[model samples]
Target: MTDFDLPEEFDEENIVSKTSIKRDMHKLQALGKRLTELKPNQLEKVPMSETLRKAIDESQRITQREATRRHMQYIGKLMRAEDAEAIQNAVDLFDASSKAFAQALHSLERWRDRLIEGGNETLSEYIHDNPNADIQHLRQLVRNAKKDLKNEKNTGASKKLFRYLRTIDDMDNETTP
Candidate 1:
């Protein structure tokens, strides 16, 4: 057909440029890399599909550079089918710096210290507040933490105690809504 008789041009808004597509691919890859960097427990808190989780877990075992790169590309591919924003929000929850996160940490630390100092009294109080908590496990951690405090050594008991408290807090958060 002649130029004057040609059909109208396609809508520009509907077209995705190659540059934006590549940029998004790279962004997803970067997010996947962040996922791989997270600790196992932290990763568990993130909402992701089983297949994507398996790919990420497998990526950790890949030591060679080329293999890791290929696996990451696969992860980026998988990420395209997932809700990137939700995953990012879940991952962000594990990080520090925000006032809420700091407050939660301080609260857990206070509970740990109270359990160590007040012995059974504090244990009973905590159990009353967190009925769903593993009482026996928390009791054991408190005992170990107290022993560690007396010895003035960093044997990780205190850390374990803090972690246990945080776990209970996370559980409560999940159950409330």
Candidate 2:
């Protein structure tokens, strides 16, 4: 049949644009890069075909820039035949359960700010929640943070306070079942 010939089985709506295909390829490539960055154990947790897994493993060994790029493209090509969403979900789940550094950092900062702003009331509440915390140390940090507030140049005290809060937070997480 000619290019314009009528075909009852053909649906124009099912056709994907070139841009869309390129976008998907780029997304798969980016995902492949993330897979390459994962540790061996973490890589194992991701659901992927054996061929795709082998491609990712090979990618890790290629240190040369251009070669690594080409190998990553190959990995991306291989991923086209695998369940990308399942693989992505596995990676995301692992990441969410990990340290979640940014979320934890923001939380610690908020606590530090509240401790400084909320005065003794907040500090008392914090101590109540974390009974094992060194009250004297926590109090000293708050006091130092308050002192540092007057001088913007001195951020050391607030940083120390953040660290102390993070330590307590981490310990609590570890103790929790």
Candidate 3:
């Protein structure tokens, strides 16, 4: 039988078929695309070959459709020679960090809302949660925010409150293991 023809009993030990190789290449290309989407600072954290890095940068600068496609394919080819697993892990970690930051921001917004609406009770709860929080400053900001809300004035106080909450969150992150 020809080498291209499958035998009646496929060899279970030989799992790397032609389709599997193509699937792997496609996965590599998708990862390359993800790497291209990352900001410069984020890209710096990823461990990649210099050649791959240059290819990704060039891909970003390319405006032509066909050129970009060819560049991405080149990137996929380069990725096959590199440690794809490590690169994937780094990207996943970056994504997790981004998600954590968003969650923290959302939590800060919820706390700000509670402080503005629930007044002293919410402030006390916040202080209890963050014992090191500047009680007087937080109270002043919340008071001003409530007044601004009542007067339908600018969101200056609300913005300040949000900044303060962010600081508290930052401090919390710093102290935690």
Measured by TM-score, the strongest candidate is 1
Query: Which residue runs of candidate 3 sit more than 4 Å off their true CA positions?
Result: 1-12, 96-177
The TM-score of predicted model 3 comes to 0.51
- Provide backbone clash counts, one per model: 0, 0, 0
Per-residue lDDT over 47-100 for candidate 2, one digit per residue giving the tens place of the 0 to 100 score:
778888888878767899999888988988998898898777656644656455
Q: Clashing residue pairs, candidate 1?
A: none
Clashing pairs for model 3 are: none
User: For model 1, how does the per-residue alpha-carbon lDDT over 34-85 read when each residue is reduced to its tens digit?
Assistant: 9999999778777889999999999988999999999999999999998998
Over 95-128, each residue of candidate 3 has an lDDT whose tens digit, in order, gives 7566645666778899999999995777888999
What is the alpha-carbon lDDT for the whole of candidate 2?
0.82
Give me the runs in candidate 1 sitting further than 4 Å from their true place.
1-9, 97-168, 173-177
What local lDDT does model 3 show for residue 148?
Answer: 99
Judged by lDDT against the true structure, how good is candidate 3? 0.86
Q: What is the lDDT of residue 171 in candidate 1?
A: 93
Location of the lowest summed lDDT over 10 successive residues in candidate 2 = 93-102
